[model samples]
Target: MNTTLFDRVSAVQADLLVTFVPSEGAFPESTAWVDGNADGQLSQLRESGVFKGGLAQTLLLPSITQDFAQPVLLVGIGKDAELSDMQARKVIAAVAAQIKSLPYASVALASRALVLKKRTQSEVTALIAQWLNEGFYNFLGFKQDDAEKATKVTDLLIEGDDEAALAIGTATANGSAFARQLGNLPGNVCTPNYLASKAQHFGEEYGIDVELLDETKMDELGMHCLLSVGRGSDQPSYLIVMHYRGGEEGEAPHVLLGKGITFDTGGISLKPGPKMDEMKYDMCGAASVFGTMKAICELKPKLNFTAVVAAAENMPSARATKPGDIVKTMSGKTVEVLNTDAEGRLVLCDALTYIERFKPKSVVDVATLTGACVVALGSVNSGMYANDDAVAESLKAASQISADKIWQMPLNEEYQQQLDSNFADIGNIGGPEAGSVTAACFLSRFTASYPWAHLDIAGVAWSGGAAKGATGRPVALLTRYLLDKAS
Candidate 1:
């Protein structure tokens, strides 16, 4: 969508004019002209309790004036003091949902109507654009009927002069949309090779350096633990790397590792048949990495960034690794494959070991690694595990800035005992209790070489049931973190 800025509401021209109304206050001065032009219609609605400006409340009215010949959408944002960043995001989401199916070609937002506490105009502008784009997103790639698709707003006009903020917001949203598209594809269409191809294409488009290590090269590097997970699938596993060097020469890059199990069927220890199709979203962690990289490429942060994806597929076949199998990782650590279902950590362990070669400034690995995370935090927050306090704090700050909820989970040495095995250095699965904590502890063993953090995104990666699609989460959080680092 095209975004333009106007200085005054009177000068704005669009198919729809959107303004936020507080629960108990006069309309914003910037929108005063709108009320005057409408001949007290807005006040009449408020006086009649038809539009009291409660949070997420909305009212639509016809336009009879020549100053703006479009319908006005009054969206309630509640009190200005209580308008937290997440609440503002929800308000914008509501607005997007209200107009998603409407045939409006253009929409104008009264910027001054959004007066979020502790947030600057630039931040508000960015938030508005980012959430609107995200809220408007729909994956219709496989849908054959055109009529079934909803009409989308083509142009967004904001009453402001923050083009840079608009750019950042738009880039972030585009990145998220890209991730959602990749994550929503069926498992058959989005294989490990497909992810590698996507990475190569991303590198070419963004002028970054891309490298792909096939199963042969990985085997040569002793990535047996990673390779063993993909032994059953015909699709080859890959260690895909992309480097973005926007900083000075020889700078230690911030590394991002992603677990890319394109389609996980639990291998020899197969999962239940119900909702098996949702396994297609197993690669969402890798998709978020791609999304973050895409945004970084667009924003061009003055810091080197490296993305590593361990791409594989897990299926039960004659060649699949069974329970009790042990494989040595690239780090020379042996892992007992007690449960094939816990495959995300298997690939990630090798990737974490491999990332130590970069001597990275910090490493953050993203993975849809556990259902225990979903059980613990539900769909509200991604589970975070970090070895370093500073890294954890930084992510916490980023989570606030991006309004992407995350709760830091414990990674105490106590959890390490659960991963112990008599036959190997460690075991892939740590029984049933605190499954998410044990998974993080497994990855932490390899991350000892660098300041590292792990994000278990199993809960927030995608929604099930009627809204069964990728949410493209944590891209906003990751991008904001990188942006802050660059600043």
Candidate 2:
């Protein structure tokens, strides 16, 4: 898809024209030409109560005159004062849903008509581009029919002059689309080795450096805890690394770690048979890392960045690590595996310890680590835990800008007691209470050397039931954070 910016509405020409109208007032001036060309059809629709410009309200009209653009779309953005970035995104989503299946090859948006409170024109423009791309995303990889795989709009024209904002929005969307594709793949196809190969491909295409550590190498480096999680499966595990150097030499790089359990069946503690198919989405955190790195490569930001993925698969078998098994991490700390299902933290702890060699300025790890987070925050917000308040605040700011919601959870030392073990230095699973907090506490033990934050995206990573697919979350949040840092 191609996105182009136009400075004036008169100069725009497309198969369809999209204009936004506020509920409380008359139509914006940008729609004047269309209204005059259509012989007041927009006003007629409002008068007849066919479209009143309510929030997310939409009305489509056919071409009445030769001069008017065919099939004009009027989307309601509610009142001017109540308008926000999130609301703007909702409006875009509504518009995308309305036009995605239509036969239009090109569409133009009257960007100046959207007046969001406390947001600049550039911000609104970027939001429009980002959400439109996201709304049109459909994973038809497994679809057999050609009709289901046909393309929608091929070109999008916006009434604005901010090309930089347009680029950022489109690049972010491209990265997210990449993440969603990887996340939607079946567990058998998207294994640890597959993820490592994808990282290598990304490195080659984007001019980054890539390295992969197989199970033998990980064992030599004392990553027994991480390796133990994949022992049950025939598939090999990997420690995948990628480096993006956009800043000055010797600058301390920001590190990103992802828990890459390609398919987690709970190992010896086998999960129930029902809904096990969704386990393929366990690697969404790693997908986000790949997505964010792709966006960074496209934008070429002036910052050094490193991404690490602990890729593995957990299954129940003879060689699988059992309950009560104690394994030593790369940090030389001992962990008693009280439950094989608590494997995300096991892989993350060793990866966190291993990244210390990079001497990162700060670290943020993304994972679908706990169901407690889903129960606590639901699917609306990702649960966040950070060892440093400054890092937490920075991520919150980025979340606000990206509209990727995150709620910070308590990381108090009080929860540390739950991870205490009788046989080893710590236990992989905490006692039933505050599971999310204790999981964060476990990862916190290894991240003491740097400013660290943990994003528990178990809830927002994917949907279930009818809308079962990855959301490609936190990619936007992480990209925004890096962009802000680079600027």
Candidate 3:
């Protein structure tokens, strides 16, 4: 919405700077490759040298520098062959992130040509634009009025061949903005009803299809597990199902599920008070799916996919479901609620059960489901667990290419044992030992009929520092994987 940013990126020329494109496996030069200015000697920068870590093996820039009219920035590529399309997007994002911080009036980039058959410059640009915006994102929603406001990034430049770069630039800006919208909304505003409304608008705008099930509809269909979480709150729950049918008519749609806990009080087993406000973002897993569904419409992959979000708010009240309560999931399995805070698994159980009706070939669910994941992996990577080895490997391949980190965690029979209950088929909270792994195990019960995987995004969904909104869009990795797989 800031017009200054729009003017800056649009008015600037892409021919101002130089980019170093190194061969595969090249390290940055110890010093800046300063070109001698009009003085016919090394530029003043060399005499007064600067260290921006531009040429670092951050993979945002190519190894060599393209000498243009202004500054030269050296970007590193760990390997050349591995410099595929997804990596290209990652480099563009990193480059755009760095560019916003520099004092340059404009900059040019000579990164590698991203080679994908149907992927156009427009899509590439959209991706870079999205990444650039996200790279400099600041989450000031929770800041006190007396706190100093953080700086906003204004100047930005995208460089490449004129036609492709310009096209990519515009799309990136739009896609990033789309992503930001999902990440920025306060949890109350992005509730199940709110998300359903957004989905309808996104569907009409992009020519996709959205089917949202209201509380009454969910009750009619007997989605008790999902309904159970929202029973505590005055706000009703919803299952938002969106269809993106871009593949061949008969191709099975790859299904995606998101945990849509808009606000989590941990129910009777409340989350500790330290950073409880972040409960608003507990729905980020669902937000990512919703955002990715929107972006996929713009990207238009050659695959049919259904994204389903079980969105709701979890609050503790006299009517709230308490620990020791047992409820039957849509899958017809009963789960004993061991801890009220373990409600994400309850919501996801029903969503996973509903996917059986679709009978898709693969399923992946994302949720900010567990704090144990944060303790184990820290905030750097989302913990990935799977029922199928091949599916997990494919996702890992996608994660590496995207650089939005994910690491494999055990989801074995042993973990299932941890969720055992004497009075029910399964228990919501796994005993505290491998809490995250146990939560995955609990969800796995409903997903047992499908070759499914789970992403516990608890750690990756947000950053503790000043960045505004959700940390970054991790769904882009999954979207990229599905796109690559379909192509």
Clashes of each: 0, 0, 21
* TM-score to true structure, per model: 0.96, 0.97, 0.78
Q: Which scores better on TM-score, 1 or 2? A: 2
TM-score of 3: 0.78
For each candidate, the alpha-carbon lDDT, in order, equals 0.89, 0.90, 0.68
Task: Please identify model 3 stretches exceeding 4 Å from their true place.
Answer: 1-44, 47-107, 110-130, 136-157, 161-180
RMSDs, each prediction?
1.6, 1.4, 6.7
Q: Order candidates by lDDT, high to low.
A: 2, 1, 3
Model 2, residue 376: displacement in angstroms? Answer: 1.0
Give the better candidate number (1 or 3) by TM-score: 1
Candidate 1 lDDT, 1-487, residue by residue in tens = 8877788887777899888777777888765677788787777777788889888898877665675568888898776655777688779988988888677889998866786777788888888889888888888757687446755688988778898888888889988998999999999999999999998898779899999999989999999999999999999999999999999999999998888999999999999999999999999999999999999999898999999999999999999999999999999999999999999999999999999889998899999999999999999899999988988999999887777899999988888899989999999989999999999999999988889999999999999999899999879989988888788
Residue 429 local lDDT, model 2: 84
Cα displacement (angstroms), candidate 2, residue 342, comes to: 0.4
lDDT of 3: 0.68
**Shift in Å, residue 362, candidate 1:** 0.5
- Which sections of candidate 2 miss by over 4 Å? 79-81
Candidate 1: list runs displaced more than 4 Å: 66-68, 79-81, 146-151
